[model samples]
Target: MIVAIKYPNGQPYHDSTHQPLSKKAADSKPVQHGHRGMSLEQELNRANEFYLQRGIANIHKKPTPIQIVHVDYPKRAAAKITEAYFQQASTTDYNGIYQGHYLDFDAKETNSPTAFPLNNLHQHQVTHLLDTKRLGGISFLIIRFTKYQETYCVPIDAINQFWERRKTERQSIPYQAIVQHGVLIQPSLYPSLPYLEAVDHII
Candidate 1:
Protein backbone atom coordinates (compact mmCIF):
# COMPACT_ATOMS: atom_id res chain seq x y z
CA MET A 1 0.00 0.00 0.00
CA ILE A 2 1.22 3.48 -0.84
CA VAL A 3 1.08 6.29 1.72
CA ALA A 4 0.77 9.96 0.95
CA ILE A 5 2.75 12.25 3.21
CA LYS A 6 2.69 16.03 3.16
CA TYR A 7 4.04 19.08 4.89
CA PRO A 8 2.08 21.54 6.98
CA ASN A 9 1.98 23.88 3.96
CA GLY A 10 0.17 21.23 1.91
CA GLN A 11 3.24 20.41 -0.16
CA PRO A 12 3.62 16.72 -0.89
CA TYR A 13 6.72 15.00 0.41
CA HIS A 14 8.66 13.09 -2.21
CA ASP A 15 10.26 9.97 -0.87
CA SER A 16 13.15 8.87 -3.04
CA THR A 17 13.34 5.14 -3.57
CA HIS A 18 16.75 3.55 -3.73
CA GLN A 19 17.62 0.44 -5.73
CA PRO A 20 20.34 -1.84 -4.50
CA LEU A 21 23.49 -1.79 -6.61
CA SER A 22 24.62 -5.08 -8.05
CA LYS A 23 27.67 -6.61 -6.42
CA LYS A 24 29.71 -6.16 -9.61
CA ALA A 25 28.54 -2.56 -10.00
CA ALA A 26 29.18 -1.81 -6.35
CA ASP A 27 32.69 -3.17 -6.67
CA SER A 28 33.33 -0.94 -9.70
CA LYS A 29 32.51 2.21 -7.73
CA PRO A 30 35.41 4.06 -6.16
CA VAL A 31 36.05 3.40 -2.50
CA GLN A 32 34.78 6.14 -0.20
CA HIS A 33 37.16 6.97 2.62
CA GLY A 34 34.23 7.75 4.92
CA HIS A 35 31.06 5.84 5.71
CA ARG A 36 29.46 5.16 2.34
CA GLY A 37 26.32 3.03 2.58
CA MET A 38 24.48 4.69 5.46
CA SER A 39 23.11 8.21 5.36
CA LEU A 40 24.11 10.89 7.90
CA GLU A 41 20.86 10.36 9.81
CA GLN A 42 21.35 6.62 10.01
CA GLU A 43 24.93 6.98 11.15
CA LEU A 44 23.89 9.45 13.83
CA ASN A 45 21.11 7.18 15.03
CA ARG A 46 23.55 4.31 15.36
CA ALA A 47 26.01 6.56 17.14
CA ASN A 48 23.33 7.82 19.49
CA GLU A 49 22.40 4.26 20.35
CA PHE A 50 26.01 3.43 21.02
CA TYR A 51 26.35 6.47 23.26
CA LEU A 52 23.24 5.48 25.15
CA GLN A 53 24.54 1.95 25.70
CA ARG A 54 27.89 3.28 26.91
CA GLY A 55 26.31 6.01 29.04
CA ILE A 56 28.22 8.57 27.03
CA ALA A 57 25.25 10.73 25.99
CA ASN A 58 21.51 10.88 25.58
CA ILE A 59 20.68 12.27 22.16
CA HIS A 60 17.91 11.42 19.72
CA LYS A 61 16.32 12.49 16.49
CA LYS A 62 13.24 14.61 17.17
CA PRO A 63 10.11 12.93 15.86
CA THR A 64 8.05 15.13 13.58
CA PRO A 65 4.44 15.17 14.69
CA ILE A 66 2.12 13.85 12.00
CA GLN A 67 -1.64 14.28 11.75
CA ILE A 68 -3.21 11.29 10.07
CA VAL A 69 -6.08 12.20 7.79
CA HIS A 70 -6.89 8.87 6.18
CA VAL A 71 -6.53 5.21 7.03
CA ASP A 72 -7.29 2.04 5.08
CA TYR A 73 -8.33 -1.16 6.75
CA PRO A 74 -7.51 -3.98 4.39
CA LYS A 75 -7.84 -6.70 7.03
CA ARG A 76 -9.64 -7.07 10.30
CA ALA A 77 -6.38 -6.85 12.26
CA ALA A 78 -4.48 -4.49 9.98
CA ALA A 79 -4.80 -0.78 9.25
CA LYS A 80 -2.59 1.31 6.99
CA ILE A 81 -2.24 5.07 6.99
CA THR A 82 -3.16 6.36 3.54
CA GLU A 83 -2.61 10.07 4.07
CA ALA A 84 -0.93 12.23 6.69
CA TYR A 85 0.42 15.74 7.17
CA PHE A 86 3.03 17.21 9.41
CA GLN A 87 1.44 18.86 12.44
CA GLN A 88 3.88 21.76 12.31
CA ALA A 89 7.31 22.75 11.08
CA SER A 90 10.12 21.03 12.92
CA THR A 91 12.57 23.03 15.03
CA THR A 92 15.63 20.86 14.39
CA ASP A 93 16.60 17.27 13.67
CA TYR A 94 18.20 16.21 16.95
CA ASN A 95 18.38 17.42 20.55
CA GLY A 96 19.29 16.13 24.00
CA ILE A 97 21.84 16.42 26.82
CA TYR A 98 25.50 15.60 26.60
CA GLN A 99 27.83 15.50 29.57
CA GLY A 100 25.91 17.97 31.70
CA HIS A 101 25.34 20.34 28.75
CA TYR A 102 22.22 20.67 26.64
CA LEU A 103 22.89 19.81 23.02
CA ASP A 104 20.72 20.82 20.09
CA PHE A 105 21.70 20.32 16.46
CA ASP A 106 20.53 19.53 12.95
CA ALA A 107 22.07 17.21 10.35
CA LYS A 108 22.18 18.21 6.68
CA GLU A 109 23.67 16.66 3.56
CA THR A 110 24.78 18.51 0.42
CA ASN A 111 25.72 16.98 -2.90
CA SER A 112 27.80 20.02 -3.83
CA PRO A 113 31.52 19.60 -3.38
CA THR A 114 32.40 23.28 -3.11
CA ALA A 115 29.87 24.84 -0.77
CA PHE A 116 26.94 24.39 1.57
CA PRO A 117 24.01 26.51 0.45
CA LEU A 118 22.48 28.73 3.10
CA ASN A 119 19.11 28.01 1.51
CA ASN A 120 19.43 24.47 2.89
CA LEU A 121 18.54 25.86 6.31
CA HIS A 122 15.29 27.60 7.18
CA GLN A 123 15.07 30.88 9.10
CA HIS A 124 13.14 29.25 11.94
CA GLN A 125 15.86 26.62 12.37
CA VAL A 126 18.53 29.30 12.50
CA THR A 127 16.54 31.23 15.07
CA HIS A 128 16.04 28.07 17.12
CA LEU A 129 19.75 27.34 17.16
CA LEU A 130 20.54 30.90 18.20
CA ASP A 131 17.92 30.75 20.91
CA THR A 132 19.34 27.48 22.20
CA LYS A 133 22.82 28.96 22.37
CA ARG A 134 21.52 32.03 24.15
CA LEU A 135 20.10 29.78 26.84
CA GLY A 136 23.64 28.41 27.44
CA GLY A 137 22.97 25.25 25.44
CA ILE A 138 25.33 23.92 22.82
CA SER A 139 23.77 24.24 19.39
CA PHE A 140 25.38 23.27 16.10
CA LEU A 141 25.00 21.45 12.78
CA ILE A 142 26.38 18.20 11.37
CA ILE A 143 26.91 18.75 7.66
CA ARG A 144 27.82 15.91 5.31
CA PHE A 145 29.15 16.45 1.83
CA THR A 146 27.95 13.50 -0.21
CA LYS A 147 30.44 13.87 -3.01
CA TYR A 148 33.42 13.79 -0.70
CA GLN A 149 31.85 11.67 2.06
CA GLU A 150 33.10 14.20 4.58
CA THR A 151 31.18 15.36 7.62
CA TYR A 152 31.83 18.39 9.83
CA CYS A 153 30.46 19.56 13.13
CA VAL A 154 29.87 23.26 12.57
CA PRO A 155 29.19 25.54 15.49
CA ILE A 156 26.13 27.81 15.36
CA ASP A 157 28.30 30.93 15.64
CA ALA A 158 30.06 30.04 12.41
CA ILE A 159 26.73 29.41 10.72
CA ASN A 160 25.29 32.72 11.99
CA GLN A 161 28.32 34.59 10.65
CA PHE A 162 27.72 33.32 7.13
CA TRP A 163 23.96 33.61 7.51
CA GLU A 164 24.36 37.35 8.25
CA ARG A 165 26.78 37.80 5.34
CA ARG A 166 24.40 36.25 2.81
CA LYS A 167 22.34 39.47 2.63
CA THR A 168 25.01 41.19 0.52
CA GLU A 169 27.51 38.37 -0.05
CA ARG A 170 27.52 34.83 -1.43
CA GLN A 171 24.40 32.84 -0.62
CA SER A 172 26.37 29.73 0.28
CA ILE A 173 29.13 29.17 2.79
CA PRO A 174 32.31 28.15 1.01
CA TYR A 175 33.68 24.66 1.72
CA GLN A 176 36.93 26.23 2.85
CA ALA A 177 35.08 28.27 5.45
CA ILE A 178 33.45 25.11 6.81
CA VAL A 179 36.79 23.31 6.96
CA GLN A 180 38.19 26.25 8.91
CA HIS A 181 35.32 26.78 11.30
CA GLY A 182 33.99 23.23 11.63
CA VAL A 183 35.59 20.18 13.14
CA LEU A 184 35.88 17.18 10.87
CA ILE A 185 34.26 14.08 12.39
CA GLN A 186 36.14 10.90 11.62
CA PRO A 187 34.04 7.73 11.38
CA SER A 188 34.58 4.95 13.88
CA LEU A 189 33.49 1.33 14.30
CA TYR A 190 31.59 1.44 17.60
CA PRO A 191 29.63 4.67 17.23
CA SER A 192 30.21 4.97 13.45
CA LEU A 193 30.26 8.81 13.25
CA PRO A 194 32.01 10.02 16.39
CA TYR A 195 30.59 13.58 16.35
CA LEU A 196 30.85 13.91 20.10
CA GLU A 197 34.61 14.27 19.85
CA ALA A 198 33.95 17.33 17.73
CA VAL A 199 31.33 18.44 20.24
CA ASP A 200 34.01 18.21 22.91
CA HIS A 201 35.84 20.96 21.04
CA ILE A 202 32.68 23.07 20.93
CA ILE A 203 32.09 22.59 24.63
Candidate 2:
Protein backbone atom coordinates (compact mmCIF):
# COMPACT_ATOMS: atom_id res chain seq x y z
CA MET A 1 0.00 0.00 0.00
CA ILE A 2 1.49 3.38 -1.01
CA VAL A 3 1.60 5.76 1.92
CA ALA A 4 2.68 9.35 2.53
CA ILE A 5 5.01 10.33 5.37
CA LYS A 6 3.71 8.35 8.34
CA TYR A 7 5.28 7.33 11.62
CA PRO A 8 5.29 3.82 13.06
CA ASN A 9 2.27 4.91 15.09
CA GLY A 10 0.34 5.44 11.81
CA GLN A 11 0.24 9.15 12.34
CA PRO A 12 -0.08 11.06 9.09
CA TYR A 13 1.74 14.10 7.74
CA HIS A 14 2.02 16.11 4.57
CA ASP A 15 5.58 17.48 4.29
CA SER A 16 6.03 17.45 8.10
CA THR A 17 2.60 19.00 8.64
CA HIS A 18 0.93 16.82 11.22
CA GLN A 19 -2.64 15.90 10.31
CA PRO A 20 -5.27 15.20 12.96
CA LEU A 21 -6.09 11.54 13.34
CA SER A 22 -9.79 12.22 13.59
CA LYS A 23 -11.35 9.01 12.32
CA LYS A 24 -8.30 6.92 11.59
CA ALA A 25 -8.19 3.32 12.73
CA ALA A 26 -5.43 3.87 15.27
CA ASP A 27 -5.51 0.68 17.28
CA SER A 28 -3.05 -0.06 20.05
CA LYS A 29 -0.16 -2.38 19.30
CA PRO A 30 -0.85 -6.06 19.82
CA VAL A 31 1.27 -7.91 22.36
CA GLN A 32 3.60 -10.66 21.22
CA HIS A 33 2.17 -13.99 22.38
CA GLY A 34 4.87 -16.58 21.91
CA HIS A 35 7.21 -18.80 23.93
CA ARG A 36 10.26 -16.51 23.62
CA GLY A 37 8.28 -13.38 24.51
CA MET A 38 9.51 -11.57 21.42
CA SER A 39 7.59 -10.11 18.55
CA LEU A 40 7.38 -12.49 15.57
CA GLU A 41 9.52 -10.08 13.55
CA GLN A 42 12.21 -9.91 16.25
CA GLU A 43 12.41 -13.67 16.68
CA LEU A 44 12.61 -14.25 12.92
CA ASN A 45 15.29 -11.59 12.57
CA ARG A 46 17.32 -13.20 15.33
CA ALA A 47 16.84 -16.61 13.73
CA ASN A 48 17.88 -15.26 10.33
CA GLU A 49 20.94 -13.62 11.86
CA PHE A 50 21.95 -16.83 13.62
CA TYR A 51 21.44 -18.90 10.48
CA LEU A 52 23.48 -16.45 8.37
CA GLN A 53 26.29 -16.43 10.95
CA ARG A 54 26.60 -20.21 11.06
CA GLY A 55 26.21 -20.42 7.26
CA ILE A 56 23.17 -22.63 7.60
CA ALA A 57 20.66 -20.57 5.62
CA ASN A 58 20.60 -17.10 4.11
CA ILE A 59 16.98 -16.24 4.94
CA HIS A 60 16.33 -12.54 5.37
CA LYS A 61 13.37 -10.22 5.79
CA LYS A 62 12.46 -8.37 2.65
CA PRO A 63 12.71 -4.66 3.30
CA THR A 64 9.76 -2.55 2.22
CA PRO A 65 11.16 -0.34 -0.54
CA ILE A 66 10.11 3.22 0.19
CA GLN A 67 10.13 6.46 -1.75
CA ILE A 68 11.66 9.32 0.14
CA VAL A 69 9.60 12.42 -0.54
CA HIS A 70 11.51 14.82 1.70
CA VAL A 71 14.80 14.88 3.62
CA ASP A 72 16.31 17.31 6.11
CA TYR A 73 19.84 17.93 4.84
CA PRO A 74 21.09 19.41 8.09
CA LYS A 75 24.63 18.35 7.23
CA ARG A 76 26.22 17.34 3.96
CA ALA A 77 27.97 14.35 5.45
CA ALA A 78 24.86 12.88 7.06
CA ALA A 79 21.52 13.79 5.61
CA LYS A 80 18.70 13.32 8.15
CA ILE A 81 15.91 11.51 6.38
CA THR A 82 12.79 13.33 7.61
CA GLU A 83 10.02 12.19 5.31
CA ALA A 84 9.58 8.92 3.46
CA TYR A 85 6.70 6.66 2.41
CA PHE A 86 6.49 2.94 1.70
CA GLN A 87 5.38 1.46 -1.58
CA GLN A 88 3.22 -1.63 -1.80
CA ALA A 89 4.94 -4.90 -0.89
CA SER A 90 4.91 -7.15 -3.95
CA THR A 91 6.02 -10.43 -2.39
CA THR A 92 5.99 -12.34 0.88
CA ASP A 93 7.68 -11.12 4.06
CA TYR A 94 10.80 -13.35 3.92
CA ASN A 95 12.66 -14.99 1.03
CA GLY A 96 16.12 -16.44 0.47
CA ILE A 97 18.14 -19.61 -0.19
CA TYR A 98 18.21 -22.57 2.17
CA GLN A 99 20.11 -25.81 1.64
CA GLY A 100 20.14 -25.39 -2.18
CA HIS A 101 16.43 -24.57 -2.29
CA TYR A 102 14.57 -21.29 -2.76
CA LEU A 103 12.46 -20.24 0.27
CA ASP A 104 9.50 -17.90 0.08
CA PHE A 105 7.06 -17.51 2.93
CA ASP A 106 5.32 -15.35 5.50
CA ALA A 107 4.78 -15.65 9.25
CA LYS A 108 1.62 -14.94 11.20
CA GLU A 109 0.37 -15.21 14.79
CA THR A 110 -3.24 -15.74 15.78
CA ASN A 111 -4.76 -15.57 19.26
CA SER A 112 -7.93 -17.36 18.27
CA PRO A 113 -8.50 -20.70 19.93
CA THR A 114 -9.60 -22.77 16.93
CA ALA A 115 -9.00 -21.48 13.41
CA PHE A 116 -6.35 -19.30 11.82
CA PRO A 117 -7.79 -16.40 9.87
CA LEU A 118 -7.05 -16.65 6.15
CA ASN A 119 -7.15 -12.87 5.84
CA ASN A 120 -3.63 -12.80 7.30
CA LEU A 121 -2.41 -13.40 3.74
CA HIS A 122 -2.78 -11.24 0.66
CA GLN A 123 -3.74 -12.33 -2.88
CA HIS A 124 -0.50 -11.12 -4.46
CA GLN A 125 1.55 -13.00 -1.88
CA VAL A 126 -0.36 -16.23 -2.55
CA THR A 127 0.24 -15.81 -6.28
CA HIS A 128 3.97 -15.21 -5.74
CA LEU A 129 4.40 -18.35 -3.65
CA LEU A 130 2.45 -20.44 -6.16
CA ASP A 131 4.71 -19.20 -8.95
CA THR A 132 7.80 -20.02 -6.88
CA LYS A 133 6.44 -23.49 -6.08
CA ARG A 134 5.93 -24.11 -9.80
CA LEU A 135 9.72 -23.63 -10.16
CA GLY A 136 10.48 -26.27 -7.47
CA GLY A 137 10.93 -23.74 -4.68
CA ILE A 138 10.06 -24.37 -1.03
CA SER A 139 7.10 -22.26 -0.04
CA PHE A 140 5.06 -22.19 3.17
CA LEU A 141 3.67 -20.12 5.98
CA ILE A 142 4.97 -20.30 9.56
CA ILE A 143 1.89 -19.88 11.70
CA ARG A 144 2.00 -19.57 15.45
CA PHE A 145 -0.96 -20.64 17.52
CA THR A 146 -0.07 -18.18 20.24
CA LYS A 147 -2.69 -19.14 22.80
CA TYR A 148 -1.93 -22.83 22.31
CA GLN A 149 1.84 -22.14 22.19
CA GLU A 150 2.30 -24.35 19.14
CA THR A 151 3.78 -23.49 15.75
CA TYR A 152 2.75 -25.14 12.52
CA CYS A 153 4.47 -25.11 9.13
CA VAL A 154 1.59 -25.26 6.66
CA PRO A 155 2.48 -25.87 3.03
CA ILE A 156 1.83 -23.08 0.55
CA ASP A 157 -0.21 -25.38 -1.68
CA ALA A 158 -2.73 -25.96 1.08
CA ILE A 159 -3.00 -22.25 1.65
CA ASN A 160 -3.32 -21.67 -2.07
CA GLN A 161 -6.18 -24.14 -2.33
CA PHE A 162 -8.05 -22.32 0.39
CA TRP A 163 -7.25 -18.88 -1.02
CA GLU A 164 -8.28 -19.72 -4.58
CA ARG A 165 -11.61 -21.17 -3.47
CA ARG A 166 -12.04 -18.85 -0.52
CA LYS A 167 -15.05 -17.22 -2.11
CA THR A 168 -16.82 -20.59 -2.30
CA GLU A 169 -15.20 -22.54 0.52
CA ARG A 170 -15.15 -19.56 2.90
CA GLN A 171 -13.51 -21.74 5.46
CA SER A 172 -10.61 -21.34 7.91
CA ILE A 173 -8.10 -24.05 8.63
CA PRO A 174 -8.95 -25.32 12.09
CA TYR A 175 -6.44 -26.43 14.73
CA GLN A 176 -7.34 -30.10 14.32
CA ALA A 177 -6.61 -29.92 10.58
CA ILE A 178 -3.36 -28.14 11.27
CA VAL A 179 -2.20 -30.94 13.55
CA GLN A 180 -3.22 -33.56 11.00
CA HIS A 181 -1.40 -31.99 8.05
CA GLY A 182 0.98 -29.37 9.49
CA VAL A 183 4.55 -29.97 10.51
CA LEU A 184 5.01 -29.05 14.15
CA ILE A 185 7.98 -26.84 14.95
CA GLN A 186 9.24 -27.17 18.49
CA PRO A 187 10.71 -24.08 20.12
CA SER A 188 14.43 -23.68 20.90
CA LEU A 189 16.99 -21.22 22.18
CA TYR A 190 19.47 -19.01 20.21
CA PRO A 191 17.31 -18.86 17.10
CA SER A 192 14.28 -18.87 19.42
CA LEU A 193 11.88 -20.39 16.85
CA PRO A 194 14.18 -23.02 15.24
CA TYR A 195 11.73 -23.51 12.36
CA LEU A 196 14.56 -24.67 10.12
CA GLU A 197 14.64 -27.89 12.10
CA ALA A 198 11.03 -28.54 11.12
CA VAL A 199 11.77 -27.62 7.51
CA ASP A 200 14.66 -30.04 7.54
CA HIS A 201 12.46 -32.84 8.79
CA ILE A 202 9.81 -32.11 6.18
CA ILE A 203 12.18 -31.77 3.22
Candidate 3:
Protein backbone atom coordinates (compact mmCIF):
# COMPACT_ATOMS: atom_id res chain seq x y z
CA MET A 1 0.00 0.00 0.00
CA ILE A 2 1.60 3.31 -1.10
CA VAL A 3 0.06 5.46 1.61
CA ALA A 4 0.81 9.16 1.15
CA ILE A 5 0.13 12.55 2.60
CA LYS A 6 -0.71 15.53 0.42
CA TYR A 7 -1.79 19.18 0.58
CA PRO A 8 -5.47 19.80 1.15
CA ASN A 9 -5.71 20.59 -2.56
CA GLY A 10 -4.38 17.04 -3.26
CA GLN A 11 -0.99 18.39 -4.33
CA PRO A 12 1.75 15.89 -3.32
CA TYR A 13 5.49 16.22 -2.65
CA HIS A 14 8.54 15.01 -4.73
CA ASP A 15 9.10 11.63 -6.44
CA SER A 16 7.55 12.61 -9.80
CA THR A 17 4.14 11.84 -8.22
CA HIS A 18 4.41 15.49 -7.12
CA GLN A 19 2.94 18.50 -8.87
CA PRO A 20 3.17 22.18 -7.89
CA LEU A 21 -0.05 23.46 -6.35
CA SER A 22 -1.77 26.53 -7.76
CA LYS A 23 -1.92 29.34 -5.13
CA LYS A 24 -5.28 29.95 -3.53
CA ALA A 25 -7.12 33.14 -4.46
CA ALA A 26 -6.50 36.00 -2.03
CA ASP A 27 -9.39 37.13 0.15
CA SER A 28 -11.40 40.05 -1.19
CA LYS A 29 -10.46 43.46 0.22
CA PRO A 30 -12.73 44.71 2.94
CA VAL A 31 -14.98 47.73 2.34
CA GLN A 32 -13.74 50.79 4.15
CA HIS A 33 -16.33 52.79 6.09
CA GLY A 34 -15.86 56.54 6.03
CA HIS A 35 -15.45 58.19 9.42
CA ARG A 36 -15.14 61.75 10.71
CA GLY A 37 -11.57 62.20 11.89
CA MET A 38 -12.52 64.87 14.43
CA SER A 39 -13.08 63.55 17.94
CA LEU A 40 -16.16 64.29 20.06
CA GLU A 41 -14.10 66.57 22.28
CA GLN A 42 -12.72 68.51 19.34
CA GLU A 43 -16.17 68.94 17.83
CA LEU A 44 -17.58 70.13 21.14
CA ASN A 45 -14.67 72.53 21.55
CA ARG A 46 -15.32 73.96 18.12
CA ALA A 47 -19.02 74.27 18.93
CA ASN A 48 -18.22 76.00 22.21
CA GLU A 49 -15.94 78.44 20.42
CA PHE A 50 -18.69 79.24 17.93
CA TYR A 51 -21.15 79.73 20.76
CA LEU A 52 -18.73 82.09 22.48
CA GLN A 53 -18.06 84.05 19.31
CA ARG A 54 -21.79 84.54 18.74
CA GLY A 55 -22.35 85.35 22.46
CA ILE A 56 -24.85 82.54 22.54
CA ALA A 57 -23.22 80.66 25.45
CA ASN A 58 -20.14 80.46 27.58
CA ILE A 59 -19.38 76.73 27.73
CA HIS A 60 -15.95 75.21 28.19
CA LYS A 61 -14.47 71.81 28.87
CA LYS A 62 -13.27 71.41 32.41
CA PRO A 63 -9.50 71.09 32.61
CA THR A 64 -8.25 68.00 34.38
CA PRO A 65 -6.40 68.95 37.53
CA ILE A 66 -2.88 67.52 37.51
CA GLN A 67 -0.50 67.49 40.47
CA ILE A 68 2.99 68.25 39.19
CA VAL A 69 5.50 66.03 40.90
CA HIS A 70 8.60 67.04 38.95
CA VAL A 71 9.48 69.71 36.36
CA ASP A 72 12.57 69.95 34.16
CA TYR A 73 13.47 73.54 33.37
CA PRO A 74 15.57 73.60 30.21
CA LYS A 75 16.63 77.21 30.80
CA ARG A 76 15.26 79.78 28.29
CA ALA A 77 12.49 77.43 27.28
CA ALA A 78 9.23 76.49 28.97
CA ALA A 79 9.47 74.04 31.89
CA LYS A 80 8.68 70.48 30.84
CA ILE A 81 6.33 68.40 32.97
CA THR A 82 8.61 65.50 33.95
CA GLU A 83 6.11 63.86 36.33
CA ALA A 84 2.48 64.51 37.12
CA TYR A 85 -0.73 62.74 38.06
CA PHE A 86 -4.39 63.70 37.98
CA GLN A 87 -5.25 65.49 41.21
CA GLN A 88 -8.80 64.23 41.15
CA ALA A 89 -11.27 62.55 38.81
CA SER A 90 -12.97 65.19 36.68
CA THR A 91 -16.74 65.33 37.16
CA THR A 92 -17.90 66.19 33.63
CA ASP A 93 -16.48 67.24 30.26
CA TYR A 94 -18.18 70.64 29.90
CA ASN A 95 -20.24 73.07 31.96
CA GLY A 96 -21.23 76.70 31.73
CA ILE A 97 -24.07 79.22 31.59
CA TYR A 98 -26.48 79.20 28.68
CA GLN A 99 -29.23 81.78 28.69
CA GLY A 100 -30.22 81.88 32.38
CA HIS A 101 -29.59 78.21 33.16
CA TYR A 102 -26.53 76.25 34.20
CA LEU A 103 -25.51 73.42 31.90
CA ASP A 104 -23.36 70.43 32.76
CA PHE A 105 -22.57 67.48 30.57
CA ASP A 106 -20.04 64.93 29.41
CA ALA A 107 -19.39 63.93 25.80
CA LYS A 108 -19.03 60.28 24.82
CA GLU A 109 -18.56 58.30 21.59
CA THR A 110 -19.44 54.67 20.99
CA ASN A 111 -19.27 52.34 18.00
CA SER A 112 -21.66 49.72 19.39
CA PRO A 113 -24.41 48.91 16.95
CA THR A 114 -27.07 47.67 19.34
CA ALA A 115 -26.49 49.62 22.51
CA PHE A 116 -24.53 52.22 24.41
CA PRO A 117 -22.77 50.42 27.23
CA LEU A 118 -23.21 51.95 30.65
CA ASN A 119 -19.58 50.98 31.16
CA ASN A 120 -18.68 54.10 29.13
CA LEU A 121 -19.92 56.11 32.13
CA HIS A 122 -18.44 56.10 35.62
CA GLN A 123 -20.31 55.90 38.92
CA HIS A 124 -18.98 59.30 39.95
CA GLN A 125 -19.90 60.82 36.61
CA VAL A 126 -23.48 59.64 37.00
CA THR A 127 -23.63 60.91 40.55
CA HIS A 128 -22.20 64.27 39.51
CA LEU A 129 -24.78 64.73 36.78
CA LEU A 130 -27.60 63.73 39.08
CA ASP A 131 -26.32 66.05 41.77
CA THR A 132 -26.09 68.86 39.28
CA LYS A 133 -29.69 68.24 38.33
CA ARG A 134 -30.67 68.31 41.98
CA LEU A 135 -28.90 71.67 42.31
CA GLY A 136 -31.04 73.22 39.56
CA GLY A 137 -28.49 72.72 36.79
CA ILE A 138 -29.37 71.20 33.43
CA SER A 139 -27.26 68.04 33.36
CA PHE A 140 -27.07 65.84 30.33
CA LEU A 141 -24.89 63.66 28.12
CA ILE A 142 -23.75 64.36 24.55
CA ILE A 143 -23.35 60.90 23.04
CA ARG A 144 -22.31 60.05 19.48
CA PHE A 145 -22.65 56.78 17.64
CA THR A 146 -19.51 56.80 15.54
CA LYS A 147 -20.65 54.03 13.27
CA TYR A 148 -23.86 55.90 12.43
CA GLN A 149 -22.48 59.43 12.67
CA GLU A 150 -25.42 60.33 14.89
CA THR A 151 -25.34 62.41 18.06
CA TYR A 152 -27.95 62.89 20.78
CA CYS A 153 -28.41 65.04 23.81
CA VAL A 154 -29.71 62.83 26.58
CA PRO A 155 -31.10 64.54 29.59
CA ILE A 156 -29.86 63.41 32.99
CA ASP A 157 -33.37 62.40 34.05
CA ALA A 158 -33.57 59.81 31.31
CA ILE A 159 -30.06 58.60 32.07
CA ASN A 160 -30.81 58.40 35.78
CA GLN A 161 -33.86 56.25 35.06
CA PHE A 162 -31.72 53.93 32.91
CA TRP A 163 -28.98 53.79 35.53
CA GLU A 164 -31.45 52.95 38.23
CA ARG A 165 -33.11 50.30 36.09
CA ARG A 166 -29.80 48.68 35.06
CA LYS A 167 -29.33 47.44 38.65
CA THR A 168 -32.00 44.82 37.95
CA GLU A 169 -32.34 45.01 34.18
CA ARG A 170 -30.20 45.16 31.03
CA GLN A 171 -26.68 46.48 31.66
CA SER A 172 -26.65 48.55 28.49
CA ILE A 173 -29.24 50.95 27.10
CA PRO A 174 -30.38 50.14 23.59
CA TYR A 175 -29.88 52.67 20.78
CA GLN A 176 -33.61 52.69 20.08
CA ALA A 177 -34.31 53.55 23.72
CA ILE A 178 -31.92 56.48 23.49
CA VAL A 179 -33.55 57.61 20.28
CA GLN A 180 -36.93 57.56 21.95
CA HIS A 181 -35.80 59.47 25.03
CA GLY A 182 -32.96 61.64 23.73
CA VAL A 183 -32.97 64.60 21.39
CA LEU A 184 -31.19 63.99 18.10
CA ILE A 185 -28.50 66.57 17.25
CA GLN A 186 -27.20 67.32 13.81
CA PRO A 187 -23.60 68.26 13.14
CA SER A 188 -23.21 71.61 11.38
CA LEU A 189 -20.70 74.01 9.84
CA TYR A 190 -20.53 76.44 12.76
CA PRO A 191 -21.30 74.50 15.92
CA SER A 192 -20.05 71.07 15.03
CA LEU A 193 -22.45 69.00 17.10
CA PRO A 194 -25.10 71.74 17.61
CA TYR A 195 -26.03 70.09 20.89
CA LEU A 196 -27.43 73.33 22.29
CA GLU A 197 -30.21 73.32 19.72
CA ALA A 198 -31.35 70.06 21.24
CA VAL A 199 -30.81 71.55 24.67
CA ASP A 200 -33.02 74.49 23.74
CA HIS A 201 -35.77 72.10 22.72
CA ILE A 202 -35.52 70.21 26.00
CA ILE A 203 -35.18 73.24 28.26
Q: How many residue pairs clash in each candidate?
A: 0, 0, 0
- Cα error of candidate 2 at position 16, Å: 31
lDDT of 3 by residue, 1-203 (tens): 78555545545544541121122311243223222577888778767766776688999998888999999977555556789998767588789999989999999889997888998988889999999999999999988888888999999899888888887998888999899999999766444477899999778
lDDT of 3: 0.80
> How do all models score by TM-score?
0.79, 0.78, 0.79
- Predictions: Cα RMSD each: 8.3, 11.0, 18.5
Give the distance in Å from residue 45's predicted Cα in candidate 3 to where it truly belongs.
0.4
Q: After superposition, how far is residue 163 of candidate 1 from its true place, in Å?
A: 0.8
Q: CA lDDT of 203 in candidate 2?
A: 63
Given candidate 1, what's the lDDT at residue 45?
Answer: 80
TM-score, cand. 1 vs. native: 0.79
Q: Write the per-residue lDDT of candidate 2 for residues 69-161, one digit (tens) a residue.
A: 888765333455678988988889899999999988899989988988788778888888889889998888888888988888888887776
Q: What residue runs in model 1 are displaced by over 4 Å at the alpha carbon?
A: 1-34, 71-80
